[model samples]
Target chain A: MSSRPGVATRARPSAVPVAPARGRRRKRSYVRLVLLLPAFVSLAFVTIYPLGFTVYASLTDWNLFNFGAPVRFVGFRNWIELWRDQNFLIAFKNTAVFVLIATPLTYLVGLMVAVALDTATVGKRFFRVLFWLPLMLSSVLVTVVIGRMMFDPFVGPVDSVLDRLGVPQVLWLANPRTAMMTIIILQVWWGTAYTIMLLVAALESLPPELNEAARVDGAGEWRAFWEITFPLLLPVSSAVFLIQIVDAWKVFDIINVLTGGGPGTATQSISLLVFQQGVQGGNISYASAMAWMLTVTIAVVAGTVYWLSRRWTD
Target chain B: MRRSKGAWFFTYGVLTAWSLLLLFPMYWVVTTSFKTRPAISGGATFVPWVDFDPSLQAWRELFSESTDRWLPFFANSLIISVVTAALASVFGMMGGYALARWRRLGPFASAQFGFLLLGQRMFPAALLALPMLIMFQDLKLLDTRVGLILLYTAFSTPFAVWLLTEFIRSVPVEIEESAMLDGSSRLGVIFRITLPLVLPGLIGVFVLVLAGAWNEYFFALVLTFSESVTVPIFLANQINQTESVGWYFVSAIGILSSFPLIIAALVLQRFIQRGLVAGAVK
Candidate 1:
């Protein structure tokens, strides 16, 4: 991704009385650094400082119970213990399953809707606004509305229809089997909007002549899509895939509002686990260890997605 | 490339169904806000006039109760979002223009730096939960509006830099340089020329950053308790007492929480389109 540095080593005579190139470049570099200084400094306080603090705290035994007590250096104890803990394990599994399931599902639905909108010339702007409605709302707000009003067993329209159809009542939030499923549904509903918009943009950017030429060559609509449009969309698809995976990985609010990681911690995520340990449980150092583990997990997951997409593209 | 009538029909049919499904929950929220208790629990009603008598009891309770914390939380959210948006815009406009034009860090270094900012966006706020609590406690910033404002600014600035850098990049560099040559200071060029050209983009970034802070859940959840709790936290705490609070009030606050962003997003949809497409590039 690098090119040769554009440093021009033009020769100049002393008679011309010109400034030295090195001095000029150095002055420009100083100005650039000054321009960049503020953002870097603020980011250091927010991102770099917090990251360093988190890593350091992970190595100590800093529980809330011992607030006024002297902090003890406990190397790798919190990490090792959390790895073996059942709650952490459950949270890990749930978060992994969520990213795996949600990202691909969002892409599939998003692509279909994007293509449909492309073909349907009528009311494109109207449909775009409708798809974007969910993205405008906060995840917490969306979760609460869906959980209480739309999915409530007794009063929710969903269960109400089921009751009218002679089916018995089923608790969506209480049962372990259905808890995560409900969250996934709400997630797909709330999230697919951005993906759809991105894909629509990608689809619209494609030159019409290419698809038309394919059609002229006797390719059907599906054939044209598979052979022509789909290949061109790979870059956009990879971006959307990686973005959705990251979005779904940090699944806290939806689960919190919908289930509160309940039915005996059935849907507890890494974020929720950290919240419970650090904020609710007041085990600061222990939660920091969990948070560090989560950070590594996210990096690995994101890296693998990027790597896999690169391989496919290659 | 041409479709049969049947195919066109199928496309419209599927889209109409999708649009309806997409709009239903929003409709349900609004209609439920206007319904009485009996009407709410009775069943799903598509028409408010036909099935249920409308009422303002929930809205009234939301605004008037002294013990209720909805209005204060709402105010906290607005203050935090506005201040964060303004501060992030300033930092991003300055830094983003430098990155766009100067190439100060050289090509590879600039790319790496940009990626670093982006990777920060993907960070889990939970990582800061325990640390921020202790840090704010030491600094006496815990549960204060200033604490949330600063935290949100830190959280939002990277995104502002990333997005606004792209926005500035889209404006041709020759324009700024020519202005600079005409007796204008560097900052003068940015203000008099570049900023006006990118004003729409700035508004887009402002609304986008504001939306991010507004929708932020984990920070509001963990960082603040009583003194500076945001609307999301307030509504979430209300959910914990669902036995007493009822669904009507929840619906009302849910509407209150998201209405501003929805309106902004609608008005700035074009800027959003440009930002999203441009944002996906390397």
Candidate 2:
């Protein structure tokens, strides 16, 4: 019986031991490279190649209709001219203010809603549905829906209600002061759902026992939230903030549909400016140059956010 | 633990307020869509609530009021969304399967995929104008539904692959191994064993990809010409129409256009939430 067992084990070992020999190993490696090659090349030709082409085009005065006509290498002039361009300057300012307002506001609203949803005893599912619904909406559609009513000046319901209730009807998307303000409103409206998702995800992952411990310590509801729930929500809050900052930097459909950078170009964002220059005015190279600049800036900001997330989480 | 007094009120108050604001845009679009031409532009009282002197004035215009081929374009949008979702899920499933099973090549490929995905759509839509225009023109695909689908798939595939890859990776290899032991082929194991488990993820990614396809405008606008216009292009066409088809019909179109996406969002919101949490955590 012992001899039979040894023979059986040896037979199995001999069959299995040298199946994937050195030649098979090489072929397998080659196959893996083949499988992964498309993803890498797609990233290259589709993604990286365009980026490189845009950079080269920026250095030349490449007109829209004449990609073949751009032989003149007009060096830093596009960059310099865009720097002095008043529209670009205004767009940059508006973009900065937008990032400042929307990022924190989104995080705040998201955290508040997430906290509220977590603490709710009834209709939890419904609340989650309502809260997460907006994040799924297309920006173009949302902007189109709200543009007219929300921006209505005279006899607009907002004005009518405010007048009846003893408040001024501020021209929301029209007035330059409140143009940015209204943009912030649109942002917070859309961004809150994203924030809520992350915050809720984080809150759920957290140990409920910590919140319970705080409650047992006789911490008031607000104090328990401030001490326990709030701190843990920070990582998620930062993540949402980073995403909004990157996204808001590219704010387009809202600015396009709502204002058309109207009332003397008050609400022009970086992206809207690029669209106008590239498409409307046919200043292709300048727009591409400016766009490349904006892209690098955003990449840096996004990189910082990622580094911070890793710094804390790790 | 002692539950605090008035907490429910606070929660309810906050939730209700946010919901109203969230719902405000949808309400505004719906109400505005019902208004008459002059009522929309003649005065600032644009809310369609009282103006429910309800007319099919706008809807009629959207469907047949154009010699410029309206119905065909709407059909184009529908076809594109459906095709993009279907193809993206199928190919994305294959790609994701390969990725999930091959993670031993690199864990970083698996670990920080979210960050890579974050930058995936970073390229501005207009930036693709020159290159895609060149490529599609060469392939004789310019102004074709096939061209747009190709572009949509290109834009959305990275995210779909990343999401589905994670979903697939979470499926234990032992399941496949057991099926293989039972004399199943690789294709059979995938169809009979792997797909059923990740079905929710597949649907979730489909919804996400389809929603993105429906929303894309810049590329669709640039890549497509006369015969291939989507709803967004149809709406953008009205931009140059001076006198008649004022913002009222625009609002109507806006509401109508949003209907499919909103319903999709509402219906799949729950499944997507589950998919995200499960795929993300695992």
| Best candidate (score: TM-score) | 1
Number of clashing residue pairs in every model?
A: 0, 0
Which candidate number has the best lDDT? 1
lDDT at residue A123 of model 1 (Cα atoms): 93
lDDT measured at residue A1 in model 1 versus the true structure, 0 to 100? 9
Model 2 TM-score is 0.87
TM-scores for all predictions: 0.93, 0.87
Q: TM-score of each model's B chain? A: 0.92, 0.83
Expressed as tens digits, the lDDT of each residue in A80-133 for candidate 1 is 999789999999999998888888888998888888888888798898878877
Clashes of 1: 0
Candidate 2: give the clashing pairs.
none
Task: Report, to 2 decimal places, the DockQ of model 1.
Answer: 0.64
